[model samples]
Target: MESVVIFDSPGKGRGLKAAKEFWAGDVIFSEASIAAVVFDSLAERICHSCFRRQEKLQRCAQCKFAHYCDRTCQRAAWPEHKVECGAIKAYGKVPNENIRLVARVLWRLDKEGSMVSDMQLTTLDELEDHINDMQEHDLKELKVDVHNFLDYWPRTSKQHLIDDISHIFGVINCNGFSVSDQKGLQAVGVGLFPNLCLVNHDCWPNCTVILNHGNQSAVSTVFHSQQRIELRSLGKIAEGEELTVSYVDYLNLSEERRRLLKTQYYFDCTCEHCKNKTHDDVKMGGKEVDGVKPSDEQVKEATDYCFQMMDKMDKARLNGDYHEVSKICRDCIEKTEPILADTHIYLLRMWSTMSEVKAYLQNFEEAAEYARKMVDGYMKLYHPNNPALGMAAMRAGVTHWQAGLIEIGHGMICKAYAILMVTHGPTHPITKDLEAMRVQTEMELRMFKENEYVYYSMREAALKNKPMTMLHEPRSVEEGIKNLFHRK
Candidate 1:
């Protein structure tokens, strides 16, 4: 019996419904991408075949563009790359990920004739493109892509009509999934997963998608280097419950989420969260200080300023101007702290950016503070077991650990591991890394508690031998660890 069945969802075109009861952490379905491509920016740094990130990669001698880890990966990718390589050489340059992806899809379809799997209820042709619903700007961009695609398309490959190419681009814009690397830390590419696309969207989804890149042990037998995705149940789902996943980050304001859905997916969300403006007040709420609360007008003004600053900060970050980004975040945070509540999304954004930039600048102590605040805000905004919250906690734990706050760092790592166990499961690379961190932290904490003098002595001796400069000096060690040896 199948684990999931397809049915026409009300309002939604088609939806996947669970055929049997599934508890949290259960794998509902696993699928491989029918077509995929590495991002153009990472084309050289990441393995074109295995999608691994490395400082140095071996470039394909033929195309002089496609890269690989070694001969094994090059051979594995040859079936697809054989055609792509010829096109890149013929065209004289590589196209964007979207165009390249469309080309790969066309090549695959021409070869296999788009056969449906036993469990697949929909085909690539049937997927909605919403071409008519697209805005003029979006359509214009699509037109540009279609033109470029035609130029880059090989004359020898199977020819596709202009309408077919346009429709394929439309489908991808709405349905394509971000393919993460093996550790699931960052998206290295984009892929088309047919059945996974059938899962509808929800503000608070009961299922989360995991892009399984396959590990060394599994790669040899069950899983391959191909891009595969898994749908995991986030909580106990009934047999007949319709499986859903969030199309956008659920942390956004209701209005923002609705705008994104309408613009990108061509659908106006009427999800309960959107309809009821759930958590909107808290996410944008203003706080009172000294018995004086901020007025609605003041709150709006402050939020507007924060939004403008965040826009600039994002651009600065993209430009690699960390100092400018840090300054903008600091200014926005200071200006809005009094008016906005601690959990306000705007403040959280600043904290998140500040944490990242500070960490990059090696201000570990300050970065850890901002990361802790970010995690605290996330804890309130996200579901108790949300994977995002777990990732944030994991990052905060690492920051704290880097700053030598072992007690708190150990606790945060344990918290992340517990949440990831449910969201990502134990076998995921990220979860495995967190588990190792948890163990190592626990051991260090035990050692420090056993004898802080000896622990500090060993650390000092190691540091003295290396003679490194400290970028961040902790203001004070936590009371728990500080008092262990001082109390006499």
Candidate 2:
């Protein structure tokens, strides 16, 4: 039987369809790719100034990782090396080639580099040709712009940096890293796999890809004779639809998503949300009875007005004007609502913004409800493993706690912690925050229990002070105090 097959998904984009219908949660295909080109732990011992993994390291004065055998190597590599040194220190590790691929692509695109000098049609053709020649594994690796670096391998010493980058891509193209669980977060490596990449863009996605890391180099594959890993539909998808996954947090606005997609992938999207012509030309409190044609100038004015409103909303958020932010977000939504439906990513963001606004206004119950709805919708699209899902879960928990729903708060917090622990591992910053919240909640529960006991004890003492005594002898105040202290 064929391992995988590609075909058109009904009304969705092109998708990898199953050659044979498989059961739910089946592994469609699994390929491992290297997670990191350079390990952070190893880099610390080596000269961070250059890509030399060393021991007995001498640290660079400019950055923490710029360790050198002596001042000579440091000085020698400084001109080409110093630029990335501080970045490495800030990130605390060198990113692998895959990450570099995305970074390089973005950097070059932003700088208008010659790499993508060709027009969009030509670039698309080149990409399609490259995909046609690739094996399943190669195709998967090629999905991310970073994996494209694999095609530029076999570099000469004259282009050492170029060669290094190419090799990094090649390594990550074949290997997958194991994420480490420290504290509450996971450590991620640069190599994002190709199969995962082909999962197209959705404002909401069904499955979430997680990273795993450890200190060993091992690769293993498990195949089932009776069952296969299946890409179960998160929502209904007709035959031949493009199976998509959200690359960014779907909780973000359409503008944010569009900007990221254009900057990262060099595509001008005409997605359902972006092509809302009617909504884009509408105004607040202005009525069009559906028969009047808007003038070109009117359309331009509406477009410019939307942009202006977005700019103002951004400024209001940055300036800490929660009230203005709330009002502006509402205005944007009210204006856009008649044109854009609820499924638009911007609408989802508006809901999130509304939740934030309500929270800021001390309307915890309403805020919590709105956050819960957002989380529910996000979970449907991205599943529980995505970081955005975890964040929504965390926010939902916080809102519940604020609203005095202790049981619900605990449940949400626990769920968030569990999801974050797997995706980010135990050592990630977000995981640490979740861990702290969990501990704090548990402590609060304990304190509440203690306070209840104290209240009961004091009430009993007050009743006894009224000279009411049972047939049995009553305990003295000293004895009672001792007993209460010793109960635990």
Q: Which candidate is the best by TM-score?
A: 1
Instruction: After the best TM-score superposition of candidate 2, give how far the Cα of residue 415 lies from its true spot, in angstroms.
Output: 6.5
- lDDT of candidate 2 vs native? 0.47
Off by over 4 Å in 2: 1-206, 213-244, 247-309, 320-347, 357-366, 376-390, 410-488
lDDT of each: 0.81, 0.47
lDDT of 2 at 411: 77
How much RMSD separates candidate 2 from the native structure? 17.3
Could you tell me which 10 consecutive residues in candidate 2 have the lowest summed lDDT?
Answer: 479-488
Question: Please, what are the lDDT tens digits per residue for candidate 2 over residues 386-425?
Answer: 5556666777787776665556767788888887665445
Writing each residue's lDDT as its tens digit, candidate 1 over 6-52 gives 89999987888999999998999888877888888788888887777
